[model samples]
Target: MESMLFASIKPMLATVGDEPFDDEDFLFEPKWDGARMLLHKQGERIEAYTRSGRRVTDKFPELKEAALAIIAEQAVLDCEGVCMNGGRAVFDDFAYRLRLGDSRRIAAAARSHPASWIAFDVLATTREHLREPLHDRKRIVNECIEPSERLSPCAFLMGRGKALYDWTKEHRLEGIVAKRRYSGYQAGVVSADWIKVKHPVEIDAIILGYRMLPVFAFVIGLHFRTVRFKPVGLVEAGISAEQRAAFLGIVAGGLHAKQEGTTQWLKPALCCRIEYRDRSDWHELSGTTFKGFLPDKRVDDCMWTY
Candidate 1:
């Protein structure tokens, strides 16, 4: 069997928005909290790539095998490679498995924290389906892919987005994504045709310092427009080592002060999105987790919310 000619394409991105009303023109799907991957299969050969076009075929052998199991002559699928634990997608476990370079460790991780591909769109079959409407592409994906333990179609709810969002919140799922039924796939673009509404309390915070001990942690501060910055809390979750290194590099040379037994303070020029529960009366964030660095956001944009 020959391998498919793979093309590096950025998957379509979703815009953040409030949950929308249930409308017949849209379909809603659960937003899996995992790495975005594109799967390509031809005959008995299969390959996978990250949303950034990084080739990760060998990183997930089980998913590759699952892709090969797909019933198709040639195909390209937009999927999320999720590591589910107790019926919930765990991003940290999925990221850890994706970073394992050793075969033995990878095998062990696969046995312990196996990943699955939740296919959301069919970009191509024997022919390209890029210009097809979302509803048509969704139908094609449902018909072409053979379901297995490691692979399954992403289920969608039609004109019931509010109910789905309520269910997602009640079940502690990541969020709900709504896509316009008539919108065509547009690679590498953050389009309004699709919107994502998360179930967490999200806020923008300013970077203050970081700790390198026991484990890596980022100390962030809260700001209210022109108000002074105040230490809110520290977050040691949801960020990968690679992301930590990248963040350190971004804050390099911006150091302002350092406490011998505490943190290395920065200039507070960087902003990041944090997901957490309500802030305590003492102004400390509860159940905080690093979401991602917000490059487009500025320090002045960070606002404190109680």
Candidate 2:
């Protein structure tokens, strides 16, 4: 059967919430640390993209099995591309996978470090379901995709976000996400209808610049107002000397870096995650520490918005 056209899509985003709360109108699920992906399948052809609309279909070729898992004529799935390590979802493993450029190496890594697409919502099947309530679309998700090792549905809990949040904390998972059961999907929008409560509230920041002199730190910033990179704070902890040397090597290998006084500024091309207590009003990350480099993420994806 020929595949019908689905509308251009972007993953819906979640607003940051202060804390987890139990409510009858919401459903909670794990806020996976894996890359946010949207898988589009048509007949035997499958394509995948990151949240910033970067095509990554070839990067994770194992995910092409979504075409087999999806029983619908055509489908659009909002999912997370997770890399597994020792039976646990490891973001670093997936980041390493994204760093590979050779197709043969990527294929080899697929077997060595297997990954899966964890579907959370279905936006289309035989027809578009953007207007359908989230709870209603859960049934459609079940109908559209058969759960398999390559692709599986994300299980959710109703009216117990705090419990799931506790579980994630105890297990050292990212956090828990709560979505309004009656809310419809809004592409590319960050709405309060879907809320994310993180364990320590991590933020993705652009590597605006770096200073290697007295402190050996990374100058992290966000693209708020978005005219230019807004300096937030320095990421001095959690990044080892080995990581620092590797990052500087990339800069030396013509990734574009220029000296600005004592700091070396680069073009907007690199990003890193930061674990912080809160975002200050003056655009600073309070009690900040380096989390990890984001290889699958776009530079502009590190925005200051909620």
Candidate 3:
């Protein structure tokens, strides 16, 4: 049979929320930390596309097998391509597999760190199901796909978002995504129909430098009374345009030291709040984002946790 090709549909995105709540109309699922992909399958032919429309079929042969295993004449699925390490999804492992261009290395990595497709939504089966309600489409996904080591339905809990979020946090999972039961899939839109609640580790850090190339980012450091200030990580997200302009002025005024390249060193006098998912093995903060400047927080008060 000739391979079938489907349009690359942009994956729907979720809006960020403060906390989780119990709602009869909502269903909660674990927000996996992995690449969002849409899988298209026809007979033995399979293809995968990322959120930005990048074709990644060659990178993950395991997921292709999983997609082909689905019992459908034609199907499209919304999923996360996850590589697990110690029972938790690891983005680094997934990225390692994604970046492999050579078939031999890709096969080797597949044997060592195989990826799985965690299906959460169904967009088509013989025909498009994009206009169907989420609850109905979810049923189609469960009915059409056979769960295996490389393919599994994303587990969900209804009307108990807070409890699910707490369980995710307790297990050190990334976060929880709550979606309206009756909401239809809106391609490329970051809709309020789905909201994400994260369990992030908060910290106070001192500003070490600033980078203004490509995008504005702050190089932050953890302060110790004995060791003074030590570099932790860089934060770029959550900084507003107004905040960026104001920070540029402040950095220019405090230019007492210099560093090579685009980084302009600043005196460890400014403090800010940062939130991150966790710390890497090198003690660097992972998924760091600026929360806000702490005008009342002194640099001496900045300390490292874990």
* Each model's Cα RMSD: 12.1, 11.0, 7.4
Instruction: Determine which window of 10 residues in candidate 3 has minimal summed lDDT.
Output: 1-10
lDDT of each: 0.82, 0.82, 0.84
lDDT of 3 by residue, 145-221 (tens): 88888888899999899999999888878889999999998989999999988888889899888888878899899
The better candidate by TM-score, 1 or 2, is 1
* Highest lDDT against the true fold, candidate: 3
TM-score for each model: 0.69, 0.68, 0.74
Evaluated at residue 162, the lDDT of candidate 2 is 95
Give one digit per residue, the lDDT tens place, for model 2 in 1-306.
123243346789998886899999999998776788888887787888777777777888786665788888788899998886655577756766777889999989999888898899988787778899999998888888888889988989999999999998887677889999999999889999999887776788889788977888888888765345888888888899888998999877776667888798887788989888444335577667898899888986788643
Please estimate how well model 1 matches the true structure, expressed as its whole-model Cα lDDT. Answer: 0.82
Better of 1 and 2 by lDDT: 1
| Model 1, runs deviating above 4 Å | 1-4, 201-306
TM-score of 2: 0.68
| TM-score: model 1 vs. ground truth | 0.69
Q: How far is candidate 1 from the true structure (C-alpha RMSD, Å)?
A: 12.1
Q: In model 2, where is the ten-residue run with the lowest total lDDT? A: 1-10
The residue-by-residue lDDT of candidate 1 on 154-194, one tens digit each, is: 99999899999888877767788999999999989999999
Structure candidate 1, residue pairs in collision: none
The number of the candidate with the highest TM-score is: 3
